[model samples]
Target: MLGYGGTSSPDDPTLEAFKYQKMLADRNVILSSCGIEIESGEKAHLVGHDFSAIFSSTIVFYYPQVALTCTLMSAPHSPPGRKMDLDVMEEITERELGFEFTAYRPFLLRDDSWQLIDAHKESLLQSCRGLTRNGSRTSCLRDA
Candidate 1:
């Protein structure tokens, strides 16, 4: 299970205390319902541990055309790293979505390390145009 809680303003001790109290109450309900015994302040610690474990497994997929990003972490063998080179990912997107490929910049590291991948600009553009005309709803609706 995954959970999130936070104190919005750490600078204000009163506000932080109030937020922590609320979190404690909410966590108590969850723990009791789940039949779990957690000591005082342990709810926050458990939540933090669970959150970190889940976040480390997360994968983010970026779609430029729709200006959308999706995070997925449920699957095994997902990439693990701070960043990924998705230059060739545009090709995969084009093929899977039946869209044309357009211009795309390859991923470059700060130290000048580059992944050698051909970016097909024209194909990407065609795919984007097709997607625009059809819209994501109609095109990918069958797959869902």
Candidate 2:
């Protein structure tokens, strides 16, 4: 999880949190456009077929960091492991959007000093699925 601390803004302590939320939403669009069956309001299950052509293709195009981060997670340090977990969460995005996999980096802003924040990886994954499902439900209702 990426956490942004040291923000001087009294009005936007949650700005980073909201930014990542939008990132997850954007990732969902990429997945749906790739032909994944992400229905609204349902938990996404990674099926074996999902691991085959569509998902594999999506991962190949959009989630290269999965392998890299997984490898790094297996390394002998806490920092690398945390980084790896972040990558893994990003991979879930690839699964959701059947896109070609790619590496992901958090957007960093420059302040007076270089401040690092944490990304909530689990929340990202959960929110993506939730948003996708919610969209699906809205569409279905509209159709009905």
Candidate 3:
């Protein structure tokens, strides 16, 4: 979520750093859509299942006592700043990574990010589908 949301946008306002205030508004809207009050999730045990971990963790950063605890599934909670916002996956991973990390390519905040997203969409969706399908499919299927 580094290139996806708030995260110190006021100090460094850019389209890539989506506004925190706007994010809060959208969160409330989602809660409203689900018939939940804006404050109903306060002090709740939050769960983050991947990149959305930023959303879960940001709530805690804004309000330290907001969530009782957070369980991050795939991605770790990023530090509460945009200091490393401009670093791409290739540069960062090249330092310590011993192998290729293909999954991160699409989210490098590049102009062609949309194209990469499009390329990975089927695999991503298929991964989600495989999980929801509960063993019905063993892997992401390549489109014929």
Candidate 4:
């Protein structure tokens, strides 16, 4: 499953990205407290051959600045790296997107799927109050 964790510092744009990393680590620690198994790996030297594994998958603690647009107005604290690292991360994300798209397909309500809607209408209405407030936003909902 893909999970998204937002940082607590959205109100402070000036906060360093590493703070979010720390929050993720803290969350992992909490999970460990709840008996989840997690790897407590040591930091590898950026300039050494051992650091090559970072290219495989991005550790949550590390957000590559190259993933974002840079300009004269950009923040000055970005890590120094070859342009190649950004390219690697982009490729990885593109590959991951293939699975992400497929995972969402089963959740999508298709035009033909409206047949199931009327049968489930009462339960749907009772559970989804937002649907009443917003009305049916999709063609399937309106058609049903």
Highest lDDT: give the candidate number: 3
Candidate that scores best on TM-score: 3
| Tens digit per residue, CA lDDT, model 2, 30-66 | 5468664334522232221311333333432344442
Q: Write the per-residue lDDT of candidate 1 for residues 1-144, one digit (tens) a residue.
A: 322234343445355433434544554577668765454323222312323433323312221122123333422333445453355655675777665332222222222322121255554445445666564433233211
lDDT of the candidates, in the order given: 0.38, 0.37, 0.58, 0.38
Once model 2 is optimally superposed onto the true structure by TM-score, how far is the C-alpha of residue 106 displaced, in angstroms? 14
Q: What lDDT does candidate 2 reach at residue 140?
A: 21
- Candidate 4 residues lying further than 4 Å off, grouped into runs, are 1-9, 17-20, 37-56, 60-144
**Per-model C-alpha RMSD:** 16.0, 19.5, 8.0, 16.0
For all predicted structures, in order, the TM-scores are 0.23, 0.20, 0.51, 0.22
> Which digits, one per residue and each the tens of the lDDT, describe model 3 over residues 34-103?
6756476534566777667877787778866656678878776786775544246544654555323343
Lowest lDDT block of 10, candidate 2: 66-75
Runs with alpha carbons beyond 4 Å of true place in candidate 2: 1-18, 40-144
For candidate 4, give the lDDT. 0.38
With a 3 Å backbone cut-off (N, CA, C), the pairs that clash in candidate 1 are: 99-127, 100-123, 100-124, 100-126, 100-127, 101-123, 101-124, 101-125, 102-124, 102-125
Once fitted onto the true fold, the runs of candidate 3 whose alpha carbons sit more than 4 angstroms away are: 1-17, 40-43, 85-92, 100-103, 106-144
**Candidate 1 vs 4: which has more TM-score:** 1
> Cα RMSD for candidate 1?
16.0
